[model samples]
Structures are given as structure tokens and as C-alpha cells.
Target: MGILDQNIDYDRPVKLADGVFWVGFADLEGRLQCNPYLIVDGDEAILIDGGSRPDFSTVMRKVLQTGVSPRQISHLIYQHYDPDLCGSIPNLESLIDSAELKIISHADNNPFIRHYSVNSPLLCIDRLERKLTMRSGRTLRFFRTPYAHSAGSFITYDETSGILFTSDLFGSAGAFSNWRLFADFDKKCLGCEVAHPERPDEHCKETASPCPWSGMHHFHRKVMPGNRQLRHAMKVVKAIGATMAAPQHGSILYRVEDIAAAIERLQRMDDIGIDGIADAASCPA
Candidate 1:
């Protein structure tokens, strides 16, 4: 994912599924982009990744645009400790006027989120019950995947939607400023007809490809430690069999084929260590 060429489609929030919406934004100062998901269930609303601290206003507005108030947010799930992944959490606690707010993450990440999750008790999934059943009967399964980018990194799989919220595991570089949502993109990939062939990748020969391999490759190499850790994580991702994958970075991925392509590509790629700066740059959208 090279610098995401700005597009008008990502200027507003878009619904990804029945009760799920993808609210991604570009950081004006950093020029990087991050995606946060809003999951609404009966009497419970889960928000995945709250953008960076500086991005709280924009992120919250997008969340509210989904007709979701802070009071409705019950759980805040963190995929990892990256500023882009869980940075806005501090602001969210102050912004949300809720009383029963609960934070969820891998047990190892408690220390990292302890600062902002003061008001709410953190329920570390790998430490406690693995499955969380919401009031809506929608269940989420959590997997402990450490050392991809951080030791407390983890992934959450939503059984209800067959979508897995992978923190940094399946992320690609660049923001999806000029991209389509999962359902539409999935249909194109599955049918071998890409809506726009302009995506930055030549890996897939599909016409007008939807696969963002170029970005994915750049991201994984720079972040992940090595193939060992990544391969172990990929096994878990493949076993989960997520039909749609939502990463803290990059576009929302739909369709098993496209998802598999990412997994396979990462599995075969080399790793980079503590790179000076990420291939993605902060630029105006």
C-alpha cells in the first residue's frame, strides 16, 4: 500500500454489514490512515480500534454518524497497542458518556491499556473465558497472537458475521481512501471482475484487481519480526476461516479467495526489523 491516493469515497462512513460499519480516516499530521469498526448488537455496541489520539474527533464523529452514541458503546476491543490501533481509547473513555463501558483485549495487553481503561474493567480474553456472548446472541472468539507487531497482539473473530477483526495481523499498507467496502469488493474478486484495476499490485492477474498485495507486502515486511511468528499467526487465521477480514489498517477484505491470497502472500514473504519509518506516509487526502 503506497501512499493512498486520495479518493472521495472514503470521505464518509460506510456500512460494511448489517450492523457493522467501517469508519476509517486519514491523519492530517501523520498522513497515515487507520480503520475502526463499529459493531452494534442488542443492548451492546463494540468498537474496534479508536484511531490515534489526535484523530478522536474525526473517529468519534464517524462513529456517531452510524447513529451510535457513546452511551451505546459497551465494549472497546483493541487488536494491538499501535497508536493507530488503540490510541484514541484515552479520548473515547472521556468522550463516551456510558457507565458500563468494558474494554477487551489479550491479557498481556492489560498493562498497555490500563492508562485509558481506568473507568472500565478490562476483560482479557486469553486470560478469562475465550468466548464473549453479546445480548444479541452474537458470539466473538478471540485468539492470542503475540509478537506480530506487539507481544499483546490478538485477533477477534465474529461468529455472527464470519468476519475476523485482525489487529496488525492481516493489515496492508496505505489507507483505503480510494477503495470499496467488503461486499462490493468481494463480489468483484470472487467473480474475477475488479471494479478498479488501479489498486497497487501486480500479484493477481485478475483484471481490475481488488487485491492490495503491494501494500500488504510492504506493511508485513516492515512490522512482523519473521516468518515463524507470522506463519504461526496465519495458521490461526486460516483455521478461523474468516469470510471477511477487517484489519486495523488497510481496506476491509471480503471473500475467502482474496483473504487466502493475503495469507499466502504473507506466509511466503520475508520480514523486516524495526524499520526507520513505514512505507506508508502521512499525506493529505
Candidate 2:
């Protein structure tokens, strides 16, 4: 699937909101980054998505060091079932108290969860039907845009801070480390842009092109959304005023500009019908 490209040192937490932190994996290149959130409110904490494959323990250790014990994590929310994002669920559950952890997933994720980890708890939500609220005063509203990235794929919106813990929706390339916190991201990302990119085969001739990122298929590919669904996701996100997108990979984009731009681009492309089970091709940098 995906190689262990870069290893991010979980030295300290990168604060995304007052009670939230970016606790996922980072890449040296600018192509993709996974930014799972560690949110602490009152005495309890919640992990949005388990980090990448290699860094699960580090993520667990970092979460425990918050003075909140392993049993303190109230919830483990899965935006979707992509292995890059949710691969650590089985391992994490073994280390922590599963009884205390309520795993959250969209309603359509039940069957997949049964196939992957039958013992794990799955809390599904119908994006078109209702919203789920966390005890920390954060309201998680879902938007079902299946096949946008994955069949059961959905986007979760946090109403409290205008943040969307989007799984794979609006991601960029590059990994942000401790030395390059959110503050220095602008400068660090500039250097990363030259060295690290989403895809490089674009520069090669059509026949000569090779897929360096074909490995990305282990996760989910970037499938173009239908005109109707694209417009709907765009309108909903803009209406919600999503200030920052905590994607499953890469550094967080502060504004909705990039996501908005992608929506516009998708609309211009030839309209494609949803197959419910199709893969999105390699994402461009």
C-alpha cells in the first residue's frame, strides 16, 4: 500500500483549536499528511482517527501523557475505514479499554466494520438524516458524499469551532513536524513544495510515465465527484464556514479556498456517475 516515508516525532501537540490537537503522522514530502486530532475537554480526551501504521504507539503514548490515562479516551471517531487512517484500531483497542471507548463511524460503515473488526463498536450516522454531538460540546454533522473518496465516505463538521475533521476530502501534500509547527508551516511548506509534491509523473511523457504514487491505492484514490454532489458538498461546506480542514493526510489548510477551488474544478470536468465502489485516482499536488 503506502511506504513509511517520514516519521514525525510526537514531541508536543499541535493545537488546532482550544481543546483539539493534531496527533497523526507527517510526511517529509508535500504530497500527503495524516492529521488525526487529539481533543481534550474537561478530564476526558477523544482521538478523531488513529494515526498512520507505524506511529500508533507514539500517538497512544502522546495521548496518555496528557495525564489522561489510556481508559480516559472517551471516543475514537473514524471518518471512514481507510487503512491509512484506521489501520490502528485493532492495535489501539488492545492497548486501551474498549469498554470506555465508543468507536464512531457513519451508518453505512456497519457492514465493513463487521468484516474488519466485529468486536469493535460502531456508531453510524446518516448525514442526510441527523447529526451526532459529542459530550465536549462539539456537534458532529455528517455529509454523505459516497464515492467522493470512498463508498462509505463522509465528512464530519464540528459546529463549535467551524472545523471539519474531514477524512480525505480536501488534502494537500507534505508533512509538518515539531520544528515546523503551525506557525512556521508557511516557510517550511515552501521548501517542501520544491522537494515534496503530490505527484511527479505529470512532468513525464504520456507513455513514459510511471506511477511512483500508485502505492496510494492502498488507501483510497481521488475520484471525481458528480456535478450534483460536488455542488452540494461545496455549498454545505461553505455555508458551514469551515475555517480549517484537518485531513487524514498532510498539513491542515487554514482556509476553505483550496477545497472551494477543487469543487469548482470538479464541476468543470466531465460529469461521472457514482458507482458506489470506485477508486479515486492519484491526487495532484
lDDT (CA) per prediction: 0.70, 0.57
Off by over 4 Å in 2: 1-10, 29-32, 127-129, 173-231, 256-285
Model 1: colliding residue pairs: 1-215, 30-282, 31-282, 31-283, 197-208
| Native-referenced Cα lDDT, model 1 | 0.70
What lDDT score goes with residue 81 in model 2?
Answer: 74
For every candidate, C-alpha RMSD to the true structure in Å:
7.9, 8.6
Minimum summed lDDT over a 10-residue window in model 1 is located at: 190-199
TM-score of each: 0.79, 0.69
Clashes of 1: 5
For 1-285, candidate 2 gives per-residue lDDT tens digits of 111122434465556676777765445444355667877777777788776557787677667666667677777777777666677777777777567677777776656655546455677766325476667566668777665555677777777667787676544332222213232122222212121123522322322322212212212223434545545555655666687766676435564554454445434333344322345344343
Best by lDDT: 1
Give residue 80's lDDT in candidate 1 (0 to 100). Answer: 73
